[model samples]
Target chain A: MRDWRYWLAEQRGTLIALAIFALMFTIYISNHPAGLTTNVAQTAANKGTLLALVAMAQTLVVITAGIDLSVGAILVLTNCIASMVVTGNAFETTLGVVFVLFVGALCGALNGLIVIYGRLQPIVATIGTGAIFFGIALILRPLPGGTVNETLADAMTGKVFGIVPASLLMLLAIVLVVWLPFCSSVIGRAAYAAGSSETAAYMSGMPIRRGKFAAYTLGGLLASIGGLFLTFFTYSGQASSATASTYTLLSIAAVVLGGVSLFGGRGSAIGAIFGAFAFRAIGDLMFVFDFDALWQPLFQGVILLLAVSIGALGLWRVRNRLEWFG
Target chain B: MSDTTMGRLSERMPRFIRRIEPPVAISFACIILLLLFGGLYSSAFLSADYLLQQLKVASFLGVIATGMMLVILLGQIDLSVPWVVAAGAMMACAATAYGPAATLAAVPIGILCGMLIGLINGIGVAYLRIPSMIVTLATNAVAQGLMVVYTGGFSPRDFATEEMRYLATGSLIPGVPNALIIWAIVGAGMVFVLTRTTFGRAVYGIGNRERAAYLSGVNTRRVVMIAFIAAGGLSAFGGVLLAGYASKAAQGMGDAYLLPAIAAVVLGGTSILGGRGSYLGTVAGVILITLLLSILSVLQMPEAGRQIIYGVVIIAMLLLYGRSPTNQ
Candidate 1:
């Protein structure tokens, strides 16, 4: 019980966000019992999984005090590349997926290299690269429509167990395989150190440049995974797949709300996952209420503001309490 | 010893060339490149009419860039410019509809609205002790939200009057645009303000060392507020001209300006981390960007290619300037 309490205390923000999610989910179920069925569950699972992948990518960069505005563009570019390469054959499709992921990593490495070697500010540099990536995506797939193999899409989106969605299974696998090691490793600690104080970290021999480069490269890799998942869910790759640039901002908000400081040096992969789920639940709740699309931007902005402020206040209070003890 | 002294003098000459080279030579190179492309691609590109049109388009961005430059000079930023521009245009359009008197009233109202937002940003940063980036970003969101609620994503119809049209499309000289003239006047005025005024000196001082300036009896907060207000007013002016040019304001029109304005400031040899800059450099930067766009248009490049190149050029410029420690 004591151990559990300590764990819960460490993740208070995530716990609170999860509690809100549960409340929202209960309301959603009460409003639309039909939406509680298998189909809706699977749909939510698929969409949430994809969004979580993108959020994870964003989280990696944000944890290092850098932001990758190019995520959406990279997603589009990867999706387009996948569409061009995958021609419905099972073997070909697998190859295409691998190719897309590789491309995504390559693109991310370019951004990381520029940031590290070129010594460009992350925001400005990424915005520029984002524009270039977006342009390339447009050139590759000039319009909205490319087909994905139905079988592959179905396999990814379908149930893996009696009731568990395949997407959930994929999410679990990814969490176990990629995130666990990455978050606990020396490299990750270096990322935290760099974010806290680059100059100090450099003085401490933390390999600051390498850490930033790795973070960005990882961000790109995660975004590509997101693109692949998005393709499976939609069963298509469109040029305008990532039209919502505001998603990047929302992802940042989610990270911050999950108790991740915008200044970086403090956050968790688990917290980011919870933040993603919380955001998804909020959107779902709004839909259940039948709010118009016009209200989306306003609602998102307000929620983001509220969430960030609450998180900041909570952190301040915690620090104040700790100071009292000292 | 004399030979060593002569060698050192020659070495310093190259260093001097390198120092003066970037702003003047780069802009000249870009202009020459644009002229070359224009000469080769299209006969119409060299005409005074084409040049004037490009100048007019450049003016809208130039005005905002000038204000942005001031904020940059103060070692801060205002991300709220986009929505402020939208709000300014919306307010102007709203005023224009009620009556001619109302339309005239909009000028001050637009300036005041911008000033109010700027003051809020300044207070948030200076007194409340918030980071400028986050504060301005939040204000941008609020402004954008308000703009959407008020305008409903459509251009307000009130700004279609003869006066508005004159402001947008009319020429002061037979071929030269009125907007270009306005841009020149604003640029000259700002240059004078920055160099001649005590407030300008204080801005540079504050940028150099806020703590030192504060100790030296400079009203740092007020100066910062004035800088933001000036930026806001300038952005509003850009918005007014944009409405005049298009005959209406649209959603996200201001978004496209964000990068270009910042780029112009950077390209003008202004440091992103602040402390050293010149209006002349910004003027050159604006011309370079405008010329680049004009050249791309003349080349008949696709929108995607143009966008890609735009980002690349800006990044390249930043990298080049950022590496030169002297700029810092």
Candidate 2:
């Protein structure tokens, strides 16, 4: 009833990302002494979930032909906020969580305002905002210590029904709530159009600016969501510049590995999530194999190079040299 | 604030000195204002020694930002600067551990290591047609990973050699530090290359439009590859200078320079989008940033406050002239 080729083409990036994750996860779990247990899966899922959320955030901006270097800072900022506010009683915790998410969205909205209305490049604007966000976080937690609601943190970090990782479930809920709705919305399609060709999108009278604004704002929100999760996982927050920068860099890598074109206008958040998982799996493979922790960075980097390089393999098939620019 | 005033200045200025674009002129003005601003706090801020100290420090960033400007001119970027810089300092220092011969050859060897990373970056961006951003990013991570593996998470025990130390800290010409001389040399070379050489023209050409440049038979790929390689080597050289200044290489030493280097480049009026900018603008930019950082520190601002100021200043400076908005 349906054209399988079209479906395959549409889902190619996601399928490839999923395959990569599955392959790497298999190798990782196989190498571990404990084999494939719920505990191991839960740990892996819990760790991978942070990067997945950030990568998802990056995906929205990338789809709009812009990059957000501030996502990590936003996450860190939200984490710091959550650490301070997400305490007291259950109602208080819930209120704090809402406040944190709001702050995240507010940060994203600021980024959107600067880029869309101030008419600045996204890269530099985000870099500026990133520094601001990190500074704010530093002010909030200068010494790297703050507390979140312990019960909430434990539950969020724990397994669901003694099997599935609760963090992963929350991540899925986010994808459903944040990404799917935005991906199918008029503004989201406008974002894709803008990314593919901004001039065309604008010429067609599409709401390109509004779409981009939504993307940047959503990107911030997602980063904050990731930040909240970080708070839950750690039960604390620290404004480490290293963490901010690392997450930002790795998120870009994850987006690329997820099959999103850095050139913009292509790919999905789910693909990015899988890409993040694959990246996490690649990093953890060293631990399972008993390699020194020192070797992890090099190992992760080499695997990332290989993964991103594979995408470049498609260029060789092009007959015209001009398409390389395209 | 307005291009109309800028147009008048260029029109009024002599053709020979026209390289000082409006943004560059504005940057120079900012430097003067910054000095005055600092003078209001402490008379020592305008003192020769203090100014000289700032100049010496700016030299390191000046050298590194030179490489970044080259890449930015090509409409690409090299995020690998930070780690490549560490690799340079680390490799140079590590080479000294191998006996006298390696010690003597350390500087070149360190730079060569960076160039090697640049080679991979160049190949990926050129032959493989990968986006410069992602490729440089991958190389940066790989460089960091390799460095970590080499050091095993500890700072290198090998101290910076006397040559590097002298180059960084010693003043051969009585008043000027060797680092300043090196920057002057590099800066002069950059100016000449950008204004006089065909390679420079090709960089601008490719950056403006890669396809058009390719069709014009400019060997666009080779030019891009060389730019990345040069950027890598220069970044490493900057790292070498930094190690010399500090007497040893520490883990993540390069991290501090990345943002400052980029900010300096953009502040100098070079378009982040590429194809337009000048060396003098960058020189003014380096000094401006150095003074700004100095004044901020002298004020005893907290790190977070300083960071906020730094970010704000960059955005404000860019807003002044770096207004090359993306497509409609």
Candidate 3:
């Protein structure tokens, strides 16, 4: 294959995810009662953006070929923290926002430390940390009642220029600011290299550990960003287990949908964003069509199964069956 | 000839000793330590009756962990457990409305449903070669959705049949909960299969290296399929017992079991990467975890604190004993 062809092949997953999201979203808007009005668009954008941020976080970790089961817990914890601190005066709210982000970064760093220095598997370590994060969140708000700065929440969640969603714009800005630099950096390449083949990356003297750590820490920050938005949208924080587990699972699905390989060294956060949007759209499609709410889980599951099965198509092309183990 | 055979056995002893055996010991040690701690906390905790009750409770977890161990042994996982468990319970309960005969068939029907799910998981994983994690997760979601639709998004109206209640709660022998007996029977059966049968050896062979096993003329795909189906069926059986214990089924009943089941399996010293572990270690793990949770509840710690403790303990155990030569 030519270089461009290889690049396209590498990007097929993301592009397909984008296409799916675009198609679903178009269908969703056209069938809706309001017909793509700002209110409806803003609502969808707000909901989708929350998952997008978390999925981006998941993408970063997954690109390193490690999973973070605690991302959702971090989201809940930060949401709870933000609800308490992201209130009162403007200066205080700014400080609170910074603090919330820092806490998330700290949580990620803790995970990184355990996985890297402690040398534990990512899945078990994160499951543990996820539990701890939830515990802390539960302590923060025993009862789900807290307020955020309404001004900030409204501004971030509301529409921009009476049409485009502000949250959507923020998502674009995050991609440009956070993902672009990370994608091009040497450490990012190191992460990809490590994920693709750790032994080879180690032999080549790549700073694989540093790269992975950065991915994990950055993943935590992104999850917190999602938490911030979640608080903004709900105007409160809830220490709900159902929400936490759902987001964690959904983020993994989105990461896969976005064309990011669970095996690592492949995919893009931008693709994951689209994947998240598409996943959310699938649920909304049910709503728009007036399907019984009970069928939503079943519908989502079938679509996810089919979507994941598509990735398995490459297995048939494997000449050596042993490669399946890899 | 006898001397040479003895020498050969001695030569292999170290390798056998080194083969991830210490974690099982460590798990037992932890159980003892936990018991001591519990005893210190409350007099009731030290009572034989209380301890027996703990064992009975642990039995439920043990059954689920047993199935989890099989899949993990094959170097695979089944994330569909939670909903499969709930589905088994709900379906079995729903069957009871058909009267006595249906009530008698409830458990078998529930297990069959689980087996069907396992078959699908097996096909996806062994045949289609999709990752088990994704496939089972999707299955879980589908099962949950179906159950929700069946129940109309409310608590299930059907109750557990008389047989289920007897199996879950009744004591056939003094101080022996029927649940414990059922678990013991399942455990014994599993031990026999794992140790005595060609199928047992195949599970280990495949877990160690599927390609190698296939090359050696083992039906690797069939083995994988069987393992997954067994896992699904066992998980569903656990669900049935849980419904019996509760005398009813409720939404999300299986949700809480998934993590703990995995934790128990891992804590028992089974490698999450697969192809290495023991039923004995898992048994210890279940008991240890049950005690930990029981004590945490006795301490009146809030749910959040309990979760934190659970997570921390799991990580600690992994670090303490899960690391073996194979992990690297």
Identify the leading candidate in terms of lDDT: 2
Off by over 4 Å in 1: A1-10, A32-35, A241-244, A310-326, B1-21, B40-44, B107-138, B151-159, B173-175, B205-222, B324-328
DockQ of 1: 0.31
Best by TM-score: 2
Fnat, 2 decimals, each candidate: 0.35, 0.64, 0.74
Q: How much of the true contact map at the interface does candidate 2 reproduce, as a fraction?
A: 0.64
lDDT of 1 by residue, A41-127 (tens): 887777677777777888788778877778888888887777677556889988988888898988899898887778776777887
Which parts of model 3 are misplaced by more than 4 Å? Answer: A1-3, B1-20, B153-156, B324-328
Residue B184 of model 2, lDDT score: 98
What are the chain A TM-scores of the candidates, in order? 0.89, 0.96, 0.97
Q: Candidates sorted by DockQ, descending order?
A: 2, 3, 1
After TM-score superposition, the amount by which residue B10's alpha carbon in candidate 1 deviates from its true location, in angstroms, is: 9.7
Off by over 4 Å in 2: B9-19, B153-156, B325-327
lDDT by residue (B1-328, candidate 2, tens digit) is: 4778767777878887665677788789988998898898889998999989999999999999999999989888788888999999999999887889999998999899999999999999988888777788789889999998888865555589999999999999999999999999999999999989999999998878889998988998899989988999999999999999999998779987887888888988888878888888889888988988888888887889877877887788777766775545
Q: Write the per-residue lDDT of candidate 2 for residues A1-326, one digit (tens) a residue.
A: 48998978977998999999999999998899999999999999988999999999999999988889899999999999999999999999889999999999999999998888778878888888898999899888988788989888889989989998999899989988889999899999999998999899889998998999999989989999899999998888999888898899889989988989877899999999999999999889878878899887787778767767877888979999899877
Best by DockQ: 2
